[model samples]
Target chain A: MTAALETFDLCKTFGALKVVDRVSLRLPQGARHALIGPNGAGKTTLVQLLSGVLRADSGRILLAGADITTSSQQRRVKQGLVRTFQVTNLFRGLSVLENVFLAVSERQGASRQMFAAAGRRRDLIERAEAIIEQLGLAGDRHRRISEIAYGQQRLVEIAVALSLDPKVLLLDEPAAGIPSRETSLLLDAVERLPPDIAILMIEHDMHVVRRFAREVSVLVGGRILMTGLPHEVMSSQEVHSVYLGQAGQKRFTAGVPHV
Target chain B: MTARSELLERHSYNPIEALYWLLLIGTFFAFPNYLSIATTVVIMALFALSLDLVLGFAGIVTLGHAAYFGIGAYTAALLASGGWREPIIDAVLAGLASAGLALMIGPALLLLDGLPLIMVTMAVSAILFEAANKASWLTGGDDGLRDFSFLPVFGLFPWSVYGQTSYLYALGWLALLFVLVRRVVSSPFGVALQGIRENRARMRLIGSPVIGHLVRAYTLSAFMAGIAGAVHAQTNKFVSLEVLGIDTSVDVVVMLVLGGIGRLYGALIGAPIYILVKHFAAEWNPYHWMFIIGALLIVAVRFGYGGLLGILGRIEAWFARARGTRKP
Candidate 1:
């Protein structure tokens, strides 16, 4: 399979801290991948570098085999390399459909329409409504972003990203602020994503990782400690170090009934 | 789809919008003695409306919008002195000149945000103000630009001493620009602007050319402000360095804030309230006019949550609820 998104020895540093040190990854087209790490493992930093939110000090980023090492965030989004924020970063003042419509209309190049009412664009509304329905957010279509629940706000984030019609969707903690009760809905929506789009979900929720990911990587201290099948990566001793072992809980790894 | 359109239409300008204009028009007959002050209110409304595009909607913190206003004023005065006396044509040219100025400096100014943005905007206006002061030959320096008159509007109606033609002339421009600005604020581009104001970073993530959009808004805002300035020059029959002064810049923001920031209707309500009070209060007690204005601002700021329109909205909502309907 061809790699849809790949990074080569990507590096970023802040002051003396090497935040994302020599991270390299590849997500083949339609790959269901997860990047798991302990706190401060640079998972978010790596996503930022890939999405062009932050510049990598060294190495390159590629999307469908073309180098996009230093493209602007907007350019990267236009080129089918879109990302969602770890925190819900939506227009809080806008309604649910308006948030999604902005993305759909931007894709349709109707944002420059200076005279016509934006809501009157049926093509944009239909696409936005369809994506909202896909995410099971149809009931909340009339609500403003601030009026929606936190978990639903997270769903709106994904809906907006989907409206961009990306080839590679980078979800930075899609389930971060979502309640456990609602995460199942998020997972169901994730499962319903178009099969052709490559997804790299950066998650701390191992349940989601186990439930959705076919393959997983463990990251610690700004480096990937291991990458393999979900079960293999989770059962490995290195993953134990990345998760429970770091807080002087190495013994906890062995004390577990089953990894 | 129709439901969404209806929802959007309801969310737009209030139904009571027609009343404000009707009252403004009624002023020509009802308050003929005060038409001059009423006309000033109309001009300032347009100016404040232009500021709303950048400062109110796009959330660009600016301190030098008067640079455009001054440019428009000077453009009209210069054109008039140069024997190009068509007022409407001169105003259009003034608008283009101001927009051209925005094109020159908007890129650099848009790069900086927050405090630096405010400082640079102030500096731009100060620079323009000084240039006018020093260039006596062209701009008349401290003496102000004078010695020019406007041709009869459309070669049909000449300007009158009782400020009759100027009142109607200014009102016509205000209505036309208001409709244009309303359309702009309702369009996709307008929604994008509000998005930029609310969450600029998110806008970039959504694939918007943030700086490019800001530049366009800034330029268009400058164009509108220039038109107001040109109208001011044509109606008042004079131009001064004050048109580009920092006080002029600050006054527009004050007008917007006192009226309601980000509401085009707020500019209309706020400008008239301000100028009318300034006119009548100064006539009553010129020495204590500042105190009167200060007290009005204090009461408005402390008690008026959304300014007058916001209060009007609350009243409308109250009435709607009283009638057991969501809207009236």
Candidate 2:
């Protein structure tokens, strides 16, 4: 079967630095993939190139067998390839429900209606409410984003992404900065997404990587160092020496004793 | 479930809105002698409303909105003097002309943001202003366009010297545009504009055509402002370079900021207060009236981020607390 999202020989350079150098990745439909690396491993840069936030200097990106390397960010989203930012980017002045409703309405093609009141769109509001409830944000749906806690804001960001009904979802550190207790809610929310939607998550937490991602890709120096089943990728010494080094390898072993 | 239902309830008709409309209509009888100034207020309010649509809702900063206004004024003046005496048709043509100009420039102009965007808009207005000035043969130069008479409203109510018909004519347009704009700002399209305003990058991620939406909004806003300009030309039977002046553009922004930026009613609230203050203060000293207006703007900005509406909202919230009622 054709991969849902595939990048072949993708290369991006920032003057003297080659941030993402000839990296190739394939995410099949419904695949649960994790991308992990230490700081400056170009994980975020790779995601940016795929989402069209940044143009790749060289290489091709194929979405469901269609070459979309030159598509604009909005066009990429319409093509079912969507991503969340590393930092929470939301409509801060609007209510949480308004934020999600805007996404849902766009999906429904109702966002172009200028005369009908948004509140009167029961279908859009109902779908938005269902998404909010699914994400455990129903209680705070009516509150403006500025009134919510940072962790709740993070969940709202995911909720906005899910509202797009993406075929290939690129999550950039969804659990970053979220408290451990709140992280469970986020993970549960992610777990509940429709199975046919492919997910590629970039996470730094070993525990989350083990719990969520079935397959793993270890990236170092702007290239994928290894890709295998989670157990094999985590246990590979090449990934350790290049990514975790000595001290990080010891911490990884100590923290995840079973792996 | 109750909370979810309450979300929809917020959009329901409030009794206060009825009272507000009644009060606006009541002003016609309450101050008959001030009808001329009142007509000016109505025109400025429409202009401010147009600015609010783009600046407040879409977060597209512009300092040269007068380009559309002047274009509309000149279009209407030329048509009326050139023997096209149908008042309503002239206004519609004027609006369309302004919208056409906006459609051409909005795509390129809206691509810029912040200081650059402001500068470009100012440049557009400056170019138009200079063009109108040098094209003396067509526009009557500094002497201004004269010798034009608007046909009576529906060929019935004549243009009275007492300004009653003019006030009612401008008020009718204001009322129509106000309802249309209010409906727009409460729609999904309006919400999306707010999304664009608040976070444009995220708006794009959600598949919203950000620049396209902004261009449409700018075009619609120019259409409304064009009507206001046409009304001014029709009522005065004149058009001049001052119609496209930077002061008119800057003044509308001040009016929008003074009343409130994003709120729809801010235009109505800001226009009358500014116009009335200018009317009275200029009477005392025409040269120094700007100082009072400037001082009022500083107070509005320093104290209330939402302008007067924000201040009133705070007061209402305080009252609700004092009465032991939960704040809405």
Candidate 3:
């Protein structure tokens, strides 16, 4: 019911480059916040910092008012802070259902029982199946991930994250490489996610972003240019200039006007 | 189920499984006549399986796994000589002690990956071997420790004789450890380690602590190797610095690779094949046997993706196609 995630005065440096330069933002519970930026705008680096995969040079990341700047990735995940990669990351040889079941097994604290068959973990399997069904992945559940289509692979990656039972989900380009038709499947999955789960996604497709995001934070040259509701941020001249460059004297409504 | 429908099922036995049963049955039928060598094969198979847990499943490459194997052997030897003759207690403690050494070294070894892991593990094995060699008072130096009785497993009476009892004892221990390790690899932890090998970064983002899992796996693998070592010591009634040496570790890796990496029963198939080849080579030409092994190893790596099983699998596929049958 409050700010589920907060980053204050965040900074990260690699050699002389300040990848995330004094970035500050608060993601309130249930807010669908979109993080859009040009390539190498430090968006992935920021995600890494927030998820404890990379430590911030100088900043604070508080989840539900508790500082988790130095927590391990596993601990951060256990605290309901989860993130997905821009590239599809899944157990390539395992069946799609098994990958999600592994996540659910970990969540249920039953993965370590040595003697019992992993398949016999009924509760874990049921939960995994339900999540797969919710993500529209049930048809492909029994298939090996490598055998699945690329779009389905991306969906499986998100489904793996969803099975973690996260409170705050950070998705790095969830729609990348997915076709327009399949992109809606991703959006539908995101939209159907429980409202209590706060989502922060990085996306290049502005149309997809505008369809789903309530708020958007625009990053330019490793700094936030402006953050506002989708329509307001789209209408801003600074955003337009930065997005389209100086050649176009006219403004585009997201992708349309630029075209 | 109809014959064609049942034959179409995808859950056919991996060729390795067929090899395992063949070897097990073959050994059971053939070994009592030549108990000494058969016993040795069983011991080697146990060691190979332990190595498989790390090399095949966890993707942890080690050329020094023999360090734990030797430690277990030495522990069991020392404890048996010190008037503590309970076989179960000796084995459990020896396994713990061996795994303890692994736990001590696994963290440092876990810091390295790929070729560096091999280098560090070999270095560690060398260090342990030198220490055992120099610690003459405890280890009996290069003379090797002997003249100890292994306690009966579950008070079995026929196991009072050295040769017969030891062979059965080792056979039973190998079976138990095999079942246990097999259970673990199929468990959730096993699947997670497989995930780690495929994409560790992805596994981490999904809440698996990659390094922690690796360490745990290494420790468990070490424990299995230790148990194998303890069995080796009891059956042979001798423990020496050579048990802790790099050659033994290399043998473990070779056995795993020869069988096929990643498959559990690969070790069972690979170890016996390794021992048979070695035994035959020793009689044929002890001097050039290592060259033969080295050449075969290179062939396995270059052509056999899943080792001997892979070759057999391809042949099976070809045969199935010729018969107008489906792929397994």
Candidate 4:
């Protein structure tokens, strides 16, 4: 299978500490991969580098075989690589639908047609509505983003990311702040996405990991400790050592791991 | 109406905006044949509105906009004085000179924010004021430049000091500037600027070159101010250092604040109120009139950051709430 996204020898350093230490990985097409690690394991930093939010001090990122390591965040989005924030970054003052509309408008190039009524664009509105409905956000579209429930806010964040028509969607803890009820809704939306696209997600909850991710990569101290099926990775002893506060002495051990 | 409805309504130009424009043009047009004081009021109102475009819509807080205005006046005076003039040449030169100065200063001003930026911009105006003062041969220095022959538009009617022609000329030019500014604010460029005002980091993440956009906006706004300045100089047949003074710069910002920043018609609404107050102040003890105006300004700012429009919006909301309550 062709690789959908690949990072080659990516390195990033803040002073002497290597936040991402010459890491490299290739994600195949249609793979639902997870990046999981203990705190300060560089998972977020790696995601930032992959999504072109931060420049890799030394490396290249290939999106469908095209180098886009140094491109801007918006350029990467335009090229079908988009990301959601760990914290929701939205136009909070505007309505929920307006947020989605602005993102869609970015694609239609109709943001400049000032005198013409922009809300009248039936096709764009329909597309936005479909995304909202698919995410179970139809009832909240007309309300200001601030008025929405927290779980709904997470859905809207994903909706904004989806608005870019991305092929490779990066979700940075999509379930972070919401209650468990909204978490399931978010996971459902992820599962139901079209199969042709690839998703790379950073998730903290083990339940979400077991439910949504087909493949998992565990990062410990800025390096990928293991990559494989979720069961295989989770059933390992080293994964347990890292999770159980004994990563410093472990070499290689295999069996059922602790939380 | 709720805040959302008020925001939506603000996007549309209400009848009040139309009325302001109508009264402005009508007064200016009728002045030569109707009244002189009305022409003066229209000219100041136009100048104030032009400054408000950058101050309000673009979220650019400036205190040196009058530097461009002064530069425009100087350019017109230099080009048209002593019979060294072509109408188009004078107008274009005035605009170019002012815009050039704005462009030169814009980049340097980028690193500053809030009071620092305001202070730096005020310094820029002061620098221009000194230049105008010291450039005796070119600008006539403290004596001020005089004897400007008004450039004839379309070679049909030359600019005149008499009530009708000058007033009509200023009105026509003001109308054209207003349209041009309206088009700019409604463009994608304007939307991007507004986005920057709302969130700079987000705008950068979305691929807007923040400094580049701001510089372009500042240059365009300065160019418009230049046109206003050229009109002012030609109207009075004189170019004075006061155009570059700190007081004039403060006055432009005051007009914007009073009218409410970022609202185009605020400039129109605010300018007339300011001028009328100033006019009355001059009539009543000019010094004490300033004290009264200062007190009013304190009240305006204390209540809301958006000035008169914010106050008006709050009142409208209160009435709507009252009506809704009564209905149930």
Candidate 5:
């Protein structure tokens, strides 16, 4: 089957420093993949390129088997590719439902309506409420983004992406700043997403990566060192000797070996 | 709560908003002698209302909205002088002329944001100012456009020096256009503009045409500003080059900022206060009147971050707490 999302020979640079260097990746439909990397591994930059925020210097991106290299960001989204930021970027001033409603109305083509009040639209409201309800934020539906807890804010990021009905979702460190207790809700939210959609998560926690991603790619210095099954990648010596060489590596793989 | 109650609760018309309109209506009878200032204030309020759509809701941060205002004034002036005696029809035509120009140029201009957007806004008005000055044969040059009189408003009431006809005429336009603006800011299009303002890139990722939506809002703003200018020309029986000047642009910004920014009422609040204070203070003490405006700005910025409406909102919250209502 064709990959749901694909990048071939993708490269980007900022002046003298190479940010993404000829790195290629793919996610087949329904595949759960993880990109594991240390700091400054260009994971976020790659996400930007895919989302068309940062133009790639020389590369081609395909969405469901069509070239979208020069497609605008809105066009990419309309074609079923979406992304969330590494940090919680939300409409802090507006209510939670309004934020999600923006995404839903955009997809439904109701946002362009200049005459009807958005709240009066029963269909838009129902869809927005259902999405909010599914994320377990039914009680906080009327609350502002600033009033929500940090963990819930992270969930909101994914909530917004899901509202777009994306075929391929790129989540950049959704659980980066949340506490251990808070991570469960974020994990649960991720697990409950529709199965047919491909997910590529950039995660630092090996436990979460092992639980969600069937395949993993290790990135170092803007290049993918290896891509394989999670077990093969964890056991590979090159991934070990890089910088997760000492205590960090042991913390992830102490008892990771399977019988 | 059920979705029905939630939507109803938020959308229900507030008594406070009703009172604001009531007070505006009362002004027509409350001070008959000051009708001239009242008319001017009503027109300025409409102008500030136009700027609110661009600067307040969309966060466009313009410094040259006077371009539309002047264009509208000139369109009406030229048409009326050329024998278009109908006031209402000319005003609508003037508004469309302004909106048309906005739709044409706004795509390129709205692409810029923050300080650059501001500087470009100023430059656009400057160009219009120079254009009007050079097109003296048509716009009447710096001497201002005159030698024309509107037919009795709708060919009924005659306009005269008592300011009665002009006052009521301008107020009618204000009320009618106010309703239009009210409908606009509550629509889904307005919500998308807010989204674009808060997070532009995210809006695009959600499939919103950022620049396209902004241009539409900008066009609407131009239409409103145009109407204000057209009304001013009709009411005053003149259209000075100053209508298209930089000072007019900055004053509208001050009015909106002082009244409030995002909420529609903020424009209503700011414009009347700015015009009334300047009108009376200049008559009382010509040299020092600006000091009062400067002081008022300081107080508004320091005490109420959102301007007068912000202060009013806080007061309402305090009263609610004091009453122990704890509304849900």
Candidate 6:
């Protein structure tokens, strides 16, 4: 079967630096994958290219077996490719419900309605409420994003992305700054997403990577160094020498990985 | 239970709605001698509302919204002078003319954001202002357009010298546009525009056509502003280069900021406050009225971040807390 998302020979250059250099990756339908790298490994840049935020110098991106390398961000989203930012990008002034309602409305194809009040739209509100409940953010629904804690804001970001009903969701470090206790909620929220929706998460926490992603891709120097099961990728010597330095390599592979 | 409460919350009558009606009805009794200024206030409110649509809601930072306003004024003046004197039709034609200009320029102009967007819009209005000023034959140059007679409202109420009919005419237009704007901002499209305003990149990733939505909102705003300009021309039976001036553009922005930026009612509140202050202060000392206005703006910005409406919102929240009610 064709992979849900595939990037072939994708290359992006910022002057002399190859942020993403000829990187090819694929995720089958319903595949749970994680992309991990040390700082400046071009993981975020790769996500940007996939989501159409940045144009690739050379490559083809296939979504459900169709080439969409030159599609606009909105077009890419319409094709079932959605993404979240590493930094919580949300409508800061708007209420959390309003933020999710916008995403739900977009998915329902009702976002263009210029007459009906969005709040009074039963379908939109119901869907938004359901998504909020699913993400365990129902209590904070009415609060402005600015008022919510950073951890809750991260969940809100995930909730917004999930509202789009994406076929391929690219989460760029959804739990980066979230506390360990709150990270469980984030993990649970991710776990509860519809199984058919393929997920590619970029995470730094080894526990999150192991618990969530069945397969992990270790990226170094703007290229995928290895792709395998979480533990295998984690224990690999290449990832250790390149990503984690000698001290990190010893601590990481000490048979007890610290989350 | 939650769903029912949500519906009730959505359908509940906001106190501001009552305030709007009260203000609308109180004008006749409150300002009997100054109906002309009142009418000007209503027109200015509509102009500010138009700017709020793009600037407040969509976050399209424009410094030259007067281009559409002037175009509408000129279109109405030209049509009336040419003997097409149907008031409603003329206003609509003026609105369409403005919308048409926006449609033409919005796609290209809206591609820019922040400072560049402001500069481009300023340049556009500047170009139009210069064109109107230089095209003496067509636009009457500095002498202004005159000799146009507005047909009576439905040919029943004549344009009275006491400004009764004119006041009512402008108020009717204001009421109509106010309802239309209220309906629009509550709509899904309006929410999406707000989304774009708050986070444009995320909006795009959610499949919202950001630029397209901005263009539409800009066109709609220009349409309303055009109507305001047409009303000005029709009431005064005149159109001048000043209609397209930068001052006109800046005045509306000040009015919007003074009242509130994002809230629709901000325009209504800001316009009257700004205009009335200008009217009285200018009479007292034309050169120094700006100082009072400037001071008021600084206070509003420094203390009340959301403008008048924001201050009222805070007061309401405080009252709710006092009453042991949860803040909505």
All candidates: CA RMSD in angstroms?
Answer: 3.1, 2.5, 4.1, 4.1, 2.8, 3.3
lDDT of 6 by residue, B148-219 (tens): 988899989999887888888998998899888877777888888888988897787788888888999999
TM-scores of all models?
0.93, 0.95, 0.89, 0.87, 0.93, 0.92
Question: TM-score of predicted model 2?
Answer: 0.95
Model 6, which residues run further than 4 Å from truth?
Answer: A13-22, A234-246, A254-259, B1-16, B29-31, B323-328
Which of 1 and 4 is ahead in TM-score? Answer: 1
User: Each candidate: how many clashes?
Assistant: 0, 0, 0, 4, 0, 0
- CA lDDT, candidate 1, residue B317: 75
**DockQ (Cα-based) for each candidate:** 0.53, 0.59, 0.41, 0.28, 0.50, 0.50
Off by over 4 Å in 3: A13-22, A39-41, A57-59, A246-259, B1-31, B151-162, B318-328
What shift in Å separates residue A34 of candidate 2 from its native position after superposition?
0.7
**Higher-ranked by DockQ: 2 or 6:** 2
lDDT of 5 by residue, B1-328 (tens): 2233332133346677888777867877898888888888999999999999888878899999999999999999899999998999999999999999899989999999999999998998899899999988888798989988889887889897888888888988888887787666677787888888888877877989889999999999999999999999999898999999999999998998899998788888899999989988999999999999999999999999889999988998789778886555
Q: DockQ: which is higher, 3 or 4?
A: 3
lDDT of 2 by residue, B10-100 (tens): 3466677777667667878998887888888999999999999999989999999999999999999999989998888999899999999
Residue A203 in model 2: shift from native, Å?
1.2
Writing each residue's lDDT as its tens digit, candidate 4 over A1-259 gives 5588888889999999999987878777787998888888999999989877789999889998889989888688778887888988876766777677666666566554544444445686678788888888877777877888878888888887787777788889988988988788888988888787789999877778888888999988888898999998887788878888545223222322565
Write one digit per residue (lDDT tens) for candidate 4, span B82-191. Answer: 67566556766788888898898888796566788888888889988998899898899999999777647768886555656667777777677777676666554555
Q: Which candidate's DockQ is highest? A: 2
DockQ versus reference, model 6: 0.50
The deviation in Å at residue B21 for candidate 4 is 2.7
Model 3 chain A is weakest, by summed lDDT over 10 consecutive residues, at A248-257
Model 6 clash count equals: 0
For candidate 5, lDDT tens digit of each residue in A91-172? 8876788888888888888778877777688798798888888888888877788888999998888888988999999988
Tens-place lDDT digits, model 1, residues B191-274: 788778888888888888788889999999999999999999999999989999998998888787778877788888889888
Clashing pairs in 4: B32-B163, B32-B164, B56-B262, B57-B262
Q: Give residue B110's lDDT in candidate 3 (0 to 100).
A: 91
How much is the lDDT of residue B247 in candidate 4? 87
